[model samples]
Target: MNSTFMLDGEEVPFTPGQTVMQAAAAAGKYIPHLCWHPDFAAHGSCKLCTVKIGGRFATACTVRAAAGQEVDNHTPELTHKRRTLLQLLFVEGNHFCPSCEKSGDCALQATAYEMGMLTPHFDHFFPDRPVDASHPDVLLEFNRCIMCELCVRASREVDGKDVFALSGRGTGSHLIVNSESGRLADTDFAATDRAAAVCPVGVILKKRVGFAIPIGKRTYDIAPISAQPAGDPDTGNKLEETP
Candidate 1:
């Protein structure tokens, strides 16, 4: 018999070793997480996936759901906390959503809207970060990075290239690219690699495809990410054909 655990007060069965995010996603529950992408290694650095497990705030990416464990999937207080964290994320970096090409479809932007974030309450950092546009097909905008590490992990685990890394420390920490040379074009990174595709924010973007979809027709413009069908875009999830 599969072990059962309480998810949002209902009993659900899942394997032991799977992380809480894995278990929740399997059960069709949307757990707000940024660094726990299934295609990459879990970096648990982003506190966005924090869940009250066993009465403590624990990152879901690192926590395992044990048998018979009672886990609260959603609560008013938890939502508030996540919103506050989102606010911090907004102010910590240079997130000019209006100018970003990934604005509509970005996960961070979607999560911010879902959390009802209107304005960043915290003082903005506004650090001047260098941009890497030397790559032929990708643009690395370091200023907009929230240090989610999805790109870093995708490079290492999915694309078989350990190109990106986190440098510096504390409040000033940010992403550093490519052998301390600060150019992604100088590295072995290919345009089609998963590393170039895993960015959830506008930090790393496809060169020409950013403006391809056009305004009022992008992913989020059509529907909020919560309303987006949770399936493969190609096969399981069908794109609506325009008349």
Candidate 2:
């Protein structure tokens, strides 16, 4: 028998060096997480993937899966915690989903639905974040950023361009462009770069292409968020392409 971990009573086998999140995703088990891309190292900032391992709490993305370890996911307490996190994210920014361009295609919006978040319980921050439209082909919708850091990782690791970074700390933290003018146009970002496609929200958009597929026919609209593929867009589990 292969080495395995007990995930909610189901046996989830894992390979050497695999994490709980990785093994779970490979087994087609859904675990809530963000700021974790297979292409880059796990960023435990999101705290959405917390799971109980042998009665102790741990972040699934960073915790290595070992044989015979008992893992508890998909429990009422965990769901409630996730719901609160989703609600906080909603009220932290001006997430006007009804009028938002990424209503259906956005991961943040879809995740809220998956977590059963019906309302933004907290008061809205309504921070006056500015949009960066200096880029000729792309727009940076700063207000929509959830600070997942996918764009930062993709730009630096995949595209080999240090075009993005998070500035400040705590509530003051924000995404910044790597340019003297603090404008994306001043940096070497392209529409085809990984950073452009890695945003899980409507923070990055190709100009003049708003709602080309329409709201009702969008990606998440066709299926619930749970129906979507797991992990940071399947980058971690993808098979290597022969060049």
Q: In angstroms, how far off is 160's CA in candidate 1?
A: 2.5
lDDT of each: 0.74, 0.83
**Candidate 2 lDDT, tens digit per residue, 29-136?**
888876777778999988889999999999999999999999999899999999899888877777888998777777777778888888888888888899999999
Candidate 2, residue 40: how far the Cα is off, in Å: 1.1
Error at 72, model 1, angstroms:
1.4
- Per-residue lDDT, model 1, residue 23, is 77
lDDT tens digits by residue: candidate 1, 136-185: 97788888898977778778877888889898898888898866577888
Count: clashes, candidate 1: 0
Compute the lDDT of residue 88 as modeled in candidate 2: 82
Model 1 misplaced regions, further than 4 Å:
229-243
Backbone clashes (count) for model 2: 0
In angstroms, how far off is 235's CA in candidate 1?
Answer: 13
